[model samples]
Target chain A: MEQPILSIQNATKIFGGGFLSSSKPIVALDRFSLDVYESQSKIITIAGESGSGKTTLANMILGFTPCTEGKITFNGIDLNQMNGEQRSFYRQEVQAIFQDPYEVYNPFFRVAHIFDMITRHFKLARSKKEAQELIEEALNLVGMRGGEILEKYPHQLSGGQRQRVMVARAYMLRPKLIVADEPVSAVDASLRAMILDIMLRLRDTRHISFLYITHDLSTAYQISDLMYVLFQGTTVERGNTAKIIEDPRHPYVQELIDSIPVPNPKIKWNMNIKLPSEEVMRMKNTVGCRFYPRCPKRMDACTKAFPPMVKVSEEHEVACYLYQ
Target chain B: MAANEKILEVLDLHVQYFTPRGAVKAANAVNLYVKAGEIVGLVGESGCGKTTVAMAILQMVQPPGRIVKGEIRINGHNIVNLSEAELRKVRWRELALIPQGAMNSLNPVLRIREQMGDAIQAHEAISARDLKARVLSLLNDVGLPERVYNMYPHELSGGMKQRVCIAMAVALNPAIIIADEPTSALDVVVQRVVAQTLLDVKKRLGVSMIMIGHDMGLQAQMVDRVAVMYAGNMVEVGPVESIFAQPLHPYTQLLIESIPSIRERKPLKVTEGLTHDLRNPPTGCCFQFRCPRVEPRCLQAQPAMIEAGPEHLVSCIHYQAR
Candidate 1:
């Protein structure tokens, strides 16, 4: 039997804009929903530009912030109603990988201390010998040795090594899901592949779901099994990674896909690239669509009310007036 | 010197950082030249010495990190031996730098107009009225609105701030502009605009540019020529078209293959192992430890860069004619 490991239903995160506040409410995320099944481990990438609320969604998944409306549940347990014991267990089941590897670790402490804390906090080992064994196993999975990295400080290890250590720590916990927010964005080009490769291995071997968040479409297409294209807190497109990458539908998605500089020098970009307009659409007052102002194929009704998600295929759905 | 030839040239450049642990050879015997109105890309991963070469070109290499050997010539003048006072005259007027972080580059306490005034006044004796006009004209070239001139850095968006930096770089009408990861901090949409802005500046001013970036995709789009660096050495140099289509060096081949393209969906063929540590770099070839097609000679001696195709130079022992 298959059950959803994580389910987000109509999650909305609104910052400010109430009776007490004079500023307009900024809708960081609006009615976003997603699901991950435990029976099938996959990488679900949330792709968006800056201010597109991808980080907000990742923070929601990490349980750092509660959605103002709707709910997020892990293994049938709602986040808004979890007890202290349940919350602790939820923390153990879900781990996070951050963007900056340098900031993740404390410069004063030995790098091995992070893994030790993970094992002790999660109660993964009963004795010091068992903890050492677990640490070695996790390190081996990420192509690192406990002997080389154990006694070293954070500064001693390279950027790639520090990021791999984070992966190793996540592996030690045996988490059901890992939320990696721009995991390789700060790392160098040569090292990005190694970190991404580790994530793929974790998915294949450990059967763990990864909620990946990034602005880089190339990397998103490389690792994601499924992808969601967000535009200003709204899910404009969602489908299998290949289908979406091959043929993007929404105007925003199309622009984003076209904007990526191709590695082939033969194909040069013209000066015809579109810049995002500065026209602000007040969410509270306006309705047709959140992307109405910047959307290339926007209709008159697109400015009247929010557009609904329309089914394009069995595995694809897009929110736009074009399909309708 | 020939008319409009070689705006900037760096020959046998070597820069090293002397730390308490050891000497980190950041740039080793690098040779590069930028022709007038051409954009040459210096592509490499972090710590591969792309930025070091850019800094050394402008004599911006700080203490503990000095250029031990090199001839950096700007219009045939050896800038490497120029004094501080002599260098100042050629600094912004002949050579300019668009630094990495756009937001951090601006003074938070100062207004945009005041910052621009400082840069313009340092070079030429311009009045306040003339400075404003000059700054506005530069900003207009980058497609920035006049309102941004009076605003603080905090008031502008990341993309707008980057435009300000671009405007400031070309304020003195320098012949060469070295942009280090100009669009790395901006979003894809903003990056495209900033990139287009760079192209516009290059076209309008006819100033040669050395764009330092790790993204090969952006490099392919913007640069006329490409140079690939590994550990501190220039592993490959060639026309952008030739290098992208048929990379001769193993390191360049691996780098081009690693980039994830939107046009195709193939598993990234990643080369194993991390980059070499500068303090204890390997003899012969820096990429020998991680190269897939490394030969015995690769371990013993560093291969000299040999011409593989028209305008294409590669450094590898096992590269054969195709």
Candidate 2:
């Protein structure tokens, strides 16, 4: 029952504003927050569909974007108010691995640019020999040989290899927290397992915390210790990975779980599923319930006001009218 | 089954791309059969020749990639040696393809209905009224509303566009539908829906299928039989249950172990190295570098597909005998 290693208190982020903006400023993160304790497993899986604010939440945690409202504390260090020098150090403590590894590096340059970029800012290595050693060490951790990986252009490497190089670059800094956004979705299907395995090792071998953002729940199940299901920027359900998956409470959570392709032919097509009519855009963007329109189990109060995050159990939390 | 009744039979199929280092063998001597009214899955990792096999079957493998030496028999006719005019007759009517990137395969500038109509009319002598009826029914069959026909490809969502592509592929209800990563670009939920629709279509029409994908879970649900490809070779294959329950190949085990399953959270076993570059591969087993139980036998030569169980074959010299 010790305090979590990291915590976020009611974080909210909104993008775009103006007279023409009749649509609600897509609430990228609706008073969103989560906790990560170092003792337990070190992966926090953030899941959502296209419009879900999964990426926005991850960016705010990495301090890439300022939260429009709310507090983000990493080891109780407020991310919003950090000064330039402090921010640079924070950058070292927190690193990122983007979804597309090919895009992470330039096609023209050798993969070593990643190491060079860090050396200019931080004293990653004491000397030329140390620097080479450091780079090779990081590459080795990502399952790459330095002789081939460091010299090759991004175009020359496979999607999985490129991602490994990206992870290696991140490892070079020895960050306490890593924000990986859909890291393996672009890679070939066979190569996906390899990348996912590397990430699993990251948490176990190095004690690195990961804020994994992905829409694929199948792989998400494998990597996450704790999962927070996000729908349209609001937390639909948050609980232990196995518990929530086995018996999801919220209707939206159930639908997301049911939507996964099980390895059975008998469990076939689901019935007339009703997704929200795009007209939900016209629904009063109020504080009551963002999911009511799409929610299968709708209530009178659902459309009237926004739902509150109620604790269903010691570790389980859900934002729904039923709880209220 | 009649020997000639096979919708598609690929024999000694080899597809290679000429790279700077040398000819990269994208596909090896893969022999497969797609009979009537059943589905076969071609599963493997990125470099495993899954996509290459699909493209070569369609004769879409352009320069750098030559069919080189093989016999692709679609509906008992050899497509490999066919002329342009003869190949044209075989393109859409006899063999249909739902290519790797479903949405991207579509012509963005054109309307959904137009492509369907053109495909149908190009081969069969159907009237305009019949074409309209056929396109609408195709849309309905794939779970899309009939109204999707009027919309542009951009207007429809990713899932919707994929369904439209599937509709077009089976517009003629060709004997075989080769869906190459049809749902790869879509999300899990969308993928399930799309996959379900394909199953429904296959059952209703009694058409044979060659479903190609990377995800074993998805492949398990859709295909009755599986052919696991690795570095252009059909490394392992059998009934879906047997393949999952008793995998014979080390690479197959590595792939299965690597996947994070929802039902179980076992520690993932990562293959040590990267996929071999086909252009300059290690002159032995494609999986030897990363195999869990590498040995001297594995380095001698690539293992041929040998039957290890009932309809189960493995192409690995380092197979651990039970």
Q: Best-fitting candidate, measured by lDDT?
A: 1
Worst 10 residues of 1 chain A by lDDT: A277-286
**TM-score of chain B in each prediction:** 0.96, 0.94
User: CA lDDT, every prediction?
Assistant: 0.88, 0.80
Please provide, for model 2 over B189-301, each residue's C-alpha lDDT reduced to its tens digit, 9 standing for 90 to 100. 66777888888888898888899887777877788888888788888888887887778887777666655567776665554466777777787787887777878877878
- Counted clashes in each candidate structure: 4, 5
Kindly list the interface RMSD, in angstroms, of each predicted candidate in the order they appear. Answer: 1.3, 2.8
Model 1 lDDT tens row, B1-322: 4545988899999999999999999998898999999999999888899999999999999989999998999888888978999999999999999988866889999999999889889989988888888999998999987888888998888888998999999999999999999999788878999999999999998989999999999999999999999999999999999998888888888888888878777775655687777899888888888888877778877788888877788878776333
What C-alpha root-mean-square deviation, in Å, does candidate 1 show against the real structure?
Answer: 1.8
| Tens digits of per-residue lDDT for model 1, A1-324 | 666878999999999989999998888888899999988999999999888899999888888999999999988999979999999998988999999999988899998889878787778899999999999999999988999999999999988889999988987888999999999998877788888888998999999989899999888888889999988888999989888888888888988888899888877776686555343533332356777766677778787778899988878899988998
| Model 2 alpha-carbon miss at residue A56, Å | 2.1
